[model samples]
Target: MHKEGKVVPLAAATDRGARTPLPCLPVLLLQVRDKAALQLRQGLQALFDNADDTLFEMADKAADRFDQHLYFEAMRDLRLKRKSIERGFLDIFYDTFARIGQVDPLGFMAANEPSRNKAQMERAASVEGMVARVLSRDGLALDQLSLRLQTLLECTLAPQHNPLGPAALSGYFLQAGRNLGVGLRVKLILLKLFERYVLRDIDVLYGEANQLLAAAGVLAELPPAPRRRAEDRRNDSRRISATLEPDDIGADSVGQAFFASIQGLLAPARGRIAPRLHAVATAQPIGTADLLRLLSHLQHYVPAAQEEDDFDLGQQLEQLLLRVSVRSGTRRRIATADEDMINLVGLLFDHIHADDNLPHSLRTLIVRLHIPLLKVALLDKGLFSRASHPARRLLNEIGAAAIGWETGSEGLRDSLHLRVERIIQRLLNDFTEDASLFAELLEDFLAFSQDERRRNELLEQRTRDAEEGRVRALQARQQVQQALNQRLRGRVLPQVVVQMLVQSWSQVLLLAWLKQGEGSPAWRNALATMDTLLASILPQRDPQALLQHVPGLLKALREGLASVALDSTATRDFFQQLELLHLRACAGAEGPAEVAEVLVAEDIVLAIAEESACAPLRQPDEHAAQLRAVQRLRIGAWVEVLDDDEPLRCKLVARVDSSDRLVFANRTGLKVREWTAQGLAQALRLGEVRLLDDGLLFERALESVLDGLRQQQVH
Candidate 1:
């Protein structure tokens, strides 16, 4: 009964004088399938977790309200249905494996399946297309995965029949999502996410499954598949594969369009500006290499970060070109291409220097990289033609990080500011003929910023949740106070009744409103009970009506009081006092000082609502536009505030509607400032605060320069 690679053994049994052997092979296969399912379950959990964050980020970054709401709703739907979807996938997987050995060939034919309608057919085609795309992308890994599965089962299985195949996995996911209230684009985005987070490492899944089956004496050994790559990584110029991410498909096209617009401006400006430059007509033009060397030489002398008058790349280049032409006796001129690069770089940096989106300190640090960037641009034209070019991305990353920076906070000591300064200095000190430095720095900076962003986002979410909770509590308290005041103010009542109404009844009212809202039956009942208690305490001519209401009213009061868990002794005393008041009302009498006193006295307790703690509903009419601007600001919008202290940089993390308050957090997601709509509007009107444009810096600069050239051409 021994077998090679067998880890478990079964006892041989006999029944009714005949030998009945167990199906050991099927049992072993089931064990292997279960082990593989466990691995897949873990992977699916991670996929859903990452998907949650991705959807939230998309919602935050969405350009329009419609898209934002769509993503947010999808996120909520996914959260509610995630467990069932995962269960459905595993159920299908387990059932598929269970039927592998038992399924009849004829029974599994197409004739046995139900016919699909037109919409179903279209949806099926779309799902199949998605599966086909995924299979095509990871064809090598999938082929080997299928081979391993077939070897273990000693059977040929089509993709749909293979429990762990891409088709099966996608089919179940699509079926589950069919009922999800999301648009086609969102569905496609989720499919892409599945490819990235789950299927991206599918080879590992099959590898572990194969290993487990082999250990259980199922195909103990097999030939290893040859290694292959999904995409080519070579020195030759080629567009980056769009398969890398969902948004990368159009990145290169956008970059090409930018270059086209830039070249349009450069061509006309070059011809008109050539005669103005005295060096252009001096002598033979120097090669781009010689121009780079001259720029690199001047780069070393660039001023430090704290220098008031920064190093002007254009001024220094002009000086260096003049000296070189004079010393050579035969005047040297910059080549057409080199001259255009210098001019374009100059215009780009000039725009950068004046960009109000970036803080003055960051602008200074970024300007220092002008020479190095110009040199890189001269060496590789991809700087303008490729969005993913290292130099261009590094510049973009720096600008993106500086979007929330402020003028007066930490001149050079800020972590981001320091990191940018270090990178710029490294380029100036190390960069020459080699342009790979940009790529190296880009990788390091991306890792650093990613970790920083994750921490900040966590803190920012907590801040938002806390502010929202505070707002909810304030609103509930205010609602309870209003209800109590409308019923009790200016009315004569006993001190005991007032105390119970304000102290005990107010809690009960607040709890009801907070739990079920103002429109719920519970909130309405709570209000009715307060009114009944007040009526029972005052004089009532209709003794019969008052007598009939006393029992139900007392029951409702006791239940309300019990819901809030007041002290037993206190509850007993309150009920006793209420009973006496009802008795006196039925007898057409009033308690001591019940008619002469009013709840308007300062000594009376009030509901939890405090006017000072809440923001005002409106601001002065003169600041109407400012208020509208504040209202228009999104959650992630960055703003710079100029106060009596240093200028503070922060992003709007939450808007508390109950208080009309805007909560702002710094880059580290620490609550740095907050203001009501009125307060913020006043600040904006007084020129003490402004919004920052957080768009990509390079793109903005290029567009600005192009627009300027277009205007000049028209003139």
Candidate 2:
């Protein structure tokens, strides 16, 4: 239109329509760990996880969707935090904030926008004052007011405030800001002043926010909160009334709902189906004493199992114990993590440990209570080899204590100085007189032992499952290796191998060689071939669409074939066949480097898939059996596996720890055999396992695991 001399005034037109930008937090500056970017990305993903608006494609592009201004605000805040390395300044700042567990800026901004409006007006008014003097009368025009107003906003401050910082005004504006240039300028000035004087500085409004967050965080930290969702508040109130002194019930206005819930719970129940519930409406932070009382109250409603089973409380009791087990205790400070965790664990353990208080028969039931919490604790601390310490000790104690209690009767003996031979005799004498009470005591002990046994079994089973999973992964890789082997034996063509083109050719070669390309053909040729193969195969697998995962599958196959266990020719031949197949399938053009961006290989399966290798790291599912239990464990618990070592030589993951059998996922059955306070030292130690990004280490360890499996199969 401009070329045709239509004179469509772009700036004028846009300026006419441009509404004033609302006061908003700058886009959030996320913590970047290269390792932890995934976490930031995940949190962002959750913000748009629903069907409303989730249009981000590239992880970087997601920045646009975030309020960049808010992010800039955050970045500016971080800069003010301290002079840091720009190379990774954002990452470092965010990492520190994340570790400190600060609220995400965007979330806070969204939730508190109305709260920010007043502050924005004040800052804008300050700017309006300064800009008033500078504006020519011509700048006062209604048509150009918006354009001229932007000029002051963009002005760099005179060595006092950065351009990104709002400019302060000496005076304020009350009205007509859009129509009058002087008023607009004054308003802008005030906006800047507010930012500089009171608003942007976190100290001003953080106290109340902190208080609110602390209450929510503590409640979230407790495992029992979620399950109590369905309970009647009236019933809960009654229960608490029965147990809590009247003064204790209403000590906190913050705990009013809690009291109400207590009152409802203790209200006389009609029958077995209508026992009391526990309080939950209160968001007040719970003290240790309060938690214990709540736990006791919850236990009261669990309904006896059966009339004669001696374990009176049925599934309700079992579930209550499970709920209690989920949140081990709140994560307080790391220095006292051990002490706090030990005390909490000790409280529960000691409760069961005392046979006289409850009875020896209930030990198994206590063990059952311990299971879900123990699992959840592992999840929280699993990523850091260092964090696993408390969990490991906890597990070990359970095992050791169980063995000790079962054989020697320490818990029971403390309560009643009786021999194992006389335990049954004394038990009948104490409970048979009151058949119902006797059943209650007997069931308690039975539940204790049975639950402990179940817990031990669950741990042992999880360990075995993890071990077998590692073995299966190795076997799956070996199947590919065998295919390469047949090709190497002259039964298959050398042109079949495809990895000569991948960047990780060296690693791939460790598993098997590409037969098609001469040697290390540019990854470009392999990519072209890959594209061609994908396009062609797309038609064949159209109905099935297995090719969607082919890229990663291929990468895994290459990794399997590329091995350097000892410069064996068999490995070379295995890869040759892979090369031939790769060439036949690919498009014959190079693949985009963009593939490297998203598909940063994190494990063996990913290593080969140049474009589809990496998978997003998952947080523990709250509903999943893990996170709902224990949390904030120290990193000093589990054993570690490190570097490119062979099996048995592979670093230990977790030994028979006195702490607990901290669970690990061994994709490659490398046991805990390394040392250092941080973790595996190479890959980020996740739980008991290492998540590897280093290609060489990945291939080497996977190969070692595979070789071990091959030998085992042969034997």
Candidate 3:
């Protein structure tokens, strides 16, 4: 526990190396603190209260005994210690507010930072991302609240010391859970619950705090936070700083750090391409602008898709350099920074072309944009640093749309294929010094893609729904057949009765299973009726005993047939035959010619065929590894299925649990294929199927380039 009268450290040190003491918080400020603590107590109560049931549900669904025990134990531990955890949380919250003026917020921040263990860093990054999302989503209310709090405190309070910010709430939660006995996964689960149940609606927390402080005569009419450049703001949001180490330059500024990373990656390649002609007499270095001008001139001359291989940027630059030397009697070389941009852009484009995730047509189009993209990078280094740069985003968007694209017979006429081609052409013909063209083209492409996406999503949803319905019906039919076989497989029954149960009663069972689910009253009643009808038709020790059930059995049969909407003539005929059989059983005489058989060969074979349509073709023992690989694939993953030599791209849209069938759809959401788990495994083993990576294009390229460079160094 914190001491009652301890002072919080100052954010800034005094000249004498002593900290400057802050004034006591105003009474109104103290009131605001109490009010926030009360609201927070309620939110925390909701978080922990819901956590118990969430943990219990997880325990019920646990895959194994150990996971089950872990969840159960966590639930019990949380239940017993929950009240104390809340108390501890509130105590820390109150203590933080009490010392809000005396303590240095940055010191608290540093102290709270998790150590560099990979798991800890990941968890911290997750929480940090949550905080960022909250800030972005609720910036206005938070700003007003911050102003009011600062006004009440008579000083600028750091965000970490705001008492009700996500950072503070997250900090309190982490500390409270620090002593819990749960594993990392459970802790993460609880953290997600905290975010969902608490932070999900945290705007209310800020609004309440702001109102209370404002009512107490704090700043009530605060202006909005000053706006920054939209590009800068976008870049800020895309920063990869959450995973940065404390000492990394990225912790300060993302752009510079990203630049440093690129430089490091490109270190080995620098000056290696079209080496500087320092030995030439009167060799002069060109300005970046002049180099960009040379590139722009070549950008217009980008070869067609057929001739891309023959067009080499390095050789062309060399030829241009030689021409400059002959014409002006002076050799010109690109500056170091300009040369670095040239090499980096070249590497990135090379990676893009080689990325198997993208289609050949799209890759060629993207490669054609290389010169224009390089110009953007040369003009605004943000293209290399910021993932959201318009030029970069345009490429990524194209890559995203092209993930499931195929080179069908439609060739260039495919709408999406055509749209992408048009976009690339526009960039080639229109883009010059105006980088805004990237943004403009990006906007237009996004609009066009959005329209296509909406239509595809609708089709995709319909496809998924249809596939799910088919699976459900298949499962229900199989179940009904199993039920019939269980009761009638070995018994000799009258042919007409057997036909009634097989053809009519089976429909009733399927309807029950589909509409009401297995084990439901409707399903159980249907099964019970079938059993009664079958027993009534067989010989009995006391024929009169069977007579008593005849009326009830007939009523039930009619009801079951009605539920399935069976044909009236068929129903009437089946009932008449059933009645005659009952009468014969009562007279202790043989019924109409029995089928003299049990299982219907045709029906059983049909069921098997229907089921085998989704059944795996591979033997478990022979292809266990491939089967495991197929099982690991999840829905929403894209894959390529090759027929002959042609590639068909589709996504795994749904998995039918009943048959282990995976349903795949093309980009427009039309069902393209279905496979049983074993069948897919066999296909994968035969190299007829391949998984496609659907990650962001630029990011993937960047990672690939870096990995290749790193490996090159190692070798």
Predicted structure with the largest TM-score when compared to the true one: 1
Candidate 1: segments with Cα more than 4 A from true spot: 1-282, 308-310, 318-329, 406-411, 519-521, 535-618, 622-628, 656-661, 671-682
lDDT of each residue in 1-715, candidate 1, tens digit only: 2133422233212111113332334445555565566556655775686566557656755789999999899989889988887877676565555555443222222342577555455545655665676566555556655665666556786656666776666665665565777776677667666665566556556666666655655545555443334332211112212432446322344334445556756765453323424435556677888888898898898888777765665566667766887788766666666666678888999999898788887897898888898887777665665555678889998998888865444656778887888899999899997877787898679768766876798799888877876777788877887787777777667778888888999899888987889899999999999888887877788888988998999899889999999999999997877777777776664444343334554333443443334223445546778888988999899988876477778999999876778988988898877888788888788787887888878878988887898897787
Q: Estimate each model's TM-score.
A: 0.63, 0.20, 0.62
For candidate 2, which ten residues in a row score worst on lDDT? 50-59
lDDT of 2 at 313: 28
Q: 2 or 3: which has the higher lDDT? A: 3
Model 2 CA deviation exceeding 4 Å by range: 1-251, 254-257, 260-476, 479-482, 485-508, 511-715
In candidate 2 the C-alpha lDDT for residue 256 amounts to: 30
Write model 3 residue lDDT over 201-251, tens digit each, in one string.
Answer: 576567667676665556756654434454653444334222221222212
Please tell me which predicted candidate would have the highest lDDT against the true structure.
3
Clashes of each: 0, 154, 5
lDDT of 2 at 310: 28
Q: After aligning candidate 1 to the native by TM-score, how far in Å is the CA of 54 from where it should be?
A: 21
